[model samples]
Structures are given as structure tokens and as C-alpha cells.
Target: MAFMKEFHDLEIQLEDIRSATNNFGDENIIGIGGFGKVYRGSITHSHSKRQIMAAFKRLDRRYGQGDPEFLKEIMMLSRYKHEHLISLLGFCKDDGEKILVYEYASHGSLDRHLSSTSLTWRQRLNICLAAARGISYLHDPNGTQQRVLHRDIKSSNILLDDNLNA
Candidate 1:
């Protein structure tokens, strides 16, 4: 909970997140991974007073990721910034629940569209290039003394926006 003080601006109430995701209903789920399911929802920013679509990653302890992993993710994402990287909007840690909120990727993950015949070769190449740039940034984050190594890299993890930008 000491981290909460350090990331006060990034703290989201559990009540708000639950209300946004409809209490994590199955209908709201957009993706699932080793950690847990990702839910799509609209949340109102406390400061901006504007509603925005977001993806909520609810941590499931049964999946093996605990507090340490969750904290590390928050730390890394909060520190690193890139156009291609998924933006961390905020997080919730209350009532024994751990959740990460992010800007929603309208086009979803690349894996879902890999077999689409409508995708042009140029679009695919652009997506790859953007993802590579993001990876490179992580490996050598600007103005940081540390290097980040993403152990997982897959189509499912490469999200795309409405413009198909990775």
C-alpha cells in the first residue's frame, strides 16, 4: 500500500472499476491470458470528467501472478512511454482485487485479424514496424538507467487501435 502514495494519481477505486465492467460480467470480457480476463468498459475520469473506453486486466491469483508481478507491471508501464505501447490509464487495488486499467484498443489484438483477407500487406508491415519500435524502446528506455526485457511477445499481445496502429 505504500506504492499507492507514490502512484496516487493512478489509483482507481474498485467501485468505479466494478461499475464500469458491470462487475466483471462475462459479456464484457474482450480477451483472456495467463493472468486473467480483460474487460472492455467505459469509465469516467475523476479529474477530466470525461468518459473513455478502457480495458481492465483483473489479476487472478490462481494464474500465478501475485502482488509482486502486479506491482512490477504498474511500475514498468508507468515509467515507460511509447506510441506503440499500450497506455496504462490507472489501476485498482481494493477489497482483495487487483486490476490494471488501460486505454482500449479498438481493433483488438493482432492475432484476431491475422487471417483476415481484407488486411493489406502494407498494413501488416506497418503494424510489425510499430511493434518492433515499441520493443526497441523497451529495451532501451529513454533517460532510464535500466533496460526492460519483455519475455512475452505475440500477436495477441500486440494491440491495434482503430487506425490499425500497433
Candidate 2:
């Protein structure tokens, strides 16, 4: 994939990514979706040198989305910054490997909670509002750029923070 100019600063060395993900060990896997498997790992902060949890999405070489879609996602993520959206920390494209790094959603996917326990009326409402706002922000045509259509929307896609705030 030919990365655009915007990818220059966000490019993460494949070695670093590999190290952070412990070579993508099975234990690191947190979820699996249509594109690839998502892993939980910790990378050292650039400035603080402290370990920070991160979600490492390594695209499957054989069955995952193509380079065009991957590149498009990187482009879109690099351009958009919203509070409700997951932050793209960086990406890796090397040795025929494609990987994306994002902020860790501590509480995990919303679906995890739905089946395990009963949510209070208030908690359910908050989850709904947050997901709606995120979708609304992505679909708003009045933004500086064109609206983004999220092809996937489901309980599993709705990540939650440490506080369970969607």
C-alpha cells in the first residue's frame, strides 16, 4: 500500500509493533472480526516510557480486507478526531504485514456486558446515547470533510472505557 503524506508521522516501525504485541501471541487476542483479530498489548509511551495499553489490530494476510480499504481507514482515522471515536495511535505496513494501533478500551466491547449481567436503566441509556452520538458524528455532512459511513454497527463494535461510558 502506498501511504499518503499524512501517514508519514503516524508510521510505526514493524519491529516496535511486533515487540509491543509479543509477536502477536495468542494470549493477546481480545476479539476477532471480519477484518482481523484484535489484540490487547502494551507499548511504551514515547515520552514517559510508561507502558500504555493498546489495541493492536493485525490484518490477516490471507483473508482480511485489501490494502485499499486498509489505507482508506488509515487516512480517515488520521483525519478525524472525535471524543467518542477510538483514537488511532499509529500503524505498521511492512514485510507484507498490515497493522493498526488504537487506544485500549479498558472495559471491552459492550456486548460482553449485555449477556453476563443485567444493566440498570440508566446504564443502558448512557450506552445508547454514546453510540448514537458516535454514529451521528460520523454521519454528519456539515463537517469539514464528507460524511463517513460506518459499514459495521453492532454491540460488539461499541467499545467501553474503564468507566463503562460506551
Best by TM-score: 1
RMSD of 2: 2.0
- Name model 2 segments beyond 4 Å from true: 1-3, 46-50
lDDT of 2 at 163: 79
**Model 1: which ten-residue window has the lowest total lDDT?**
139-148
lDDT of 2 at 19: 85
Note the Cα lDDT for every prediction shown. Answer: 0.91, 0.83
The reply for model 1, stretches above 4 Å from the true place, is: none
Estimate, for each residue in 1-166, the C-alpha lDDT of model 1 and write its tens digit: 6866888899999999989999999999999888788999999976688999999999998888889988988888887778989989999989999999998999999999999999899999999999999999888877573788898999999999999999
- State the TM-score for model 2: 0.90
lDDT of 2: 0.83
**TM-score on alpha carbons, each prediction:** 0.95, 0.90
Give the top-scoring candidate (lDDT): 1
Clashing pairs in 1: none
